[model samples]
Target: MDAPIRKHNATDEERFWAKVDKSGDCWTWTAAKTNGYGVFRIKPRNMVAHKVSYIWAHGPVPKGYEVDHMCFNRSCVNPAHLRLLTHQENGQNRTGANTNSKSGVRGVYWAQGQWIARACIGPKTILVGRFDDLGEAERAITEWRIEHMPVSLRDRRRRVSGPLADA
Candidate 1:
């Protein structure tokens, strides 16, 4: 998971760099994109541009580890904004709350007419507490998240008092 990174090859790097538009902070890929991620066709297969960028900056990606964009930008190829994470670790940065959640917060839910604050780390659900007020529930979950979740996995643009993100 902590493997070092280095550019794979010069020819591949040259071809990959040609398609990227480094206009601003988040270097964007100007070529074919599948689901907003850049795709490059090599002899063997296609590689995601951000993954290529990660490889160019770091090294080969470890198995089962995903390249996550901390800035919430799918087209960004900036290596500094990218990180390698497990599926569960990456899930913590999700913008949308659960679809069935009434409180519209990641770990806060409404059940039996009361607000419930809870969070899941790995396979276990940690029940923060129950609250009558929604704000209190949000605060409880926020506190739990701040105390428990790793700092790099936390969502910076989390909904404070609005609908669950762009679900």
Candidate 2:
């Protein structure tokens, strides 16, 4: 006869850690995932692993704030790399431009020999400005982000340098 599937009565913490692959920087979850993010069952409902980690480390996520992966790894369940952010803030923190984008930078594109910078807030798209140089376009986008987006949404790794460093 085939062996029966054994079910161990593990605690939430134990169950949570048991599925984590601690070998990597991300502490990647080895359990079921949806859209690259880890999913866990908590009796009546399914919960996201990173959210569970956040709740375990801190308290429940604040109202209107969703858990965001600071490392940008969807499968990461490390509490240290998680933060609660508003939807708009989370969108602002997104990395990389669309694959089809000719210009490498997000929100800045080359048109008619000039680099045009633009930004979207909700449904409205605002034209930041047009510049002759790529660096200037980048600076314009950066400045617009600083002025409009929250500080938490800004790229933490980006060091302040170049012409807009003082600004």
Candidate 3:
């Protein structure tokens, strides 16, 4: 079944910002930029948080923790929906073009009895390693991403399809 539709609008971003309290404590402050990019806590990267939970649930500047926007909209600041996650757990929810570009284990082919890991780095797809199990392939890519991509930028790429794209 399809998920229920949440409220959405392209109205002025200023409308949301007015509801935040910029001078309050970290847990209670209005954590958003004036531009309505969503509530952002000032820091190295302007961490995005939901206004209700007063929790920033995305990007890596917070360090050692993972934030995920349950609403799925980067510009959405509904605190009730934000969730904290581990770096690994956050990676599991990723969906986008970068993840879809025939990369990682998604495009690999194994011989009848073999297990292999592969990904597209740019224009070419290459082998990551040969493993005995799918779990091992997952570990390889996880390690590769941790080593090569920045914490804040991990799985940051996103792709939207279907009716939503028409907007």
The top-ranked prediction according to lDDT is 2
Ranking by lDDT: 2, 1, 3
State how far residue 62 of model 3 sits from its true place (Å): 9.3
Error of 2 at 71 (Å): 1.7
lDDT for 166 in candidate 1 is: 34
**What are the models' TM-scores?**
0.78, 0.79, 0.34
**87-116: candidate 2 lDDT, tens digit per residue:** 877888877567887888788988988999
lDDT of 2: 0.83
Candidate 1 lDDT over residue span 1-167, tens digit each: 88534456658878788788888999988889999998987779998889889987999889989999987888999999999998888876676578887778778888888999888888999899999998788766776775677643444345333332332
In model 3, state the lDDT of residue 76.
54
Looking at model 2, which ten-residue stretch has the lowest summed lDDT? Answer: 151-160
Would you list the clashing residue pairs of candidate 3?
Answer: 21-30, 31-39, 31-40, 32-39, 32-40, 57-67, 57-68, 96-159, 104-119
Number of clashes recorded per candidate: 3, 0, 9
lDDT for predicted candidate 3 compared with the true structure: 0.48
Better of 2 and 3 by lDDT: 2
Q: Candidate 1, after superposition: displacement of residue 162 in Å? A: 12
As a TM-score, model 3 comes out at 0.34
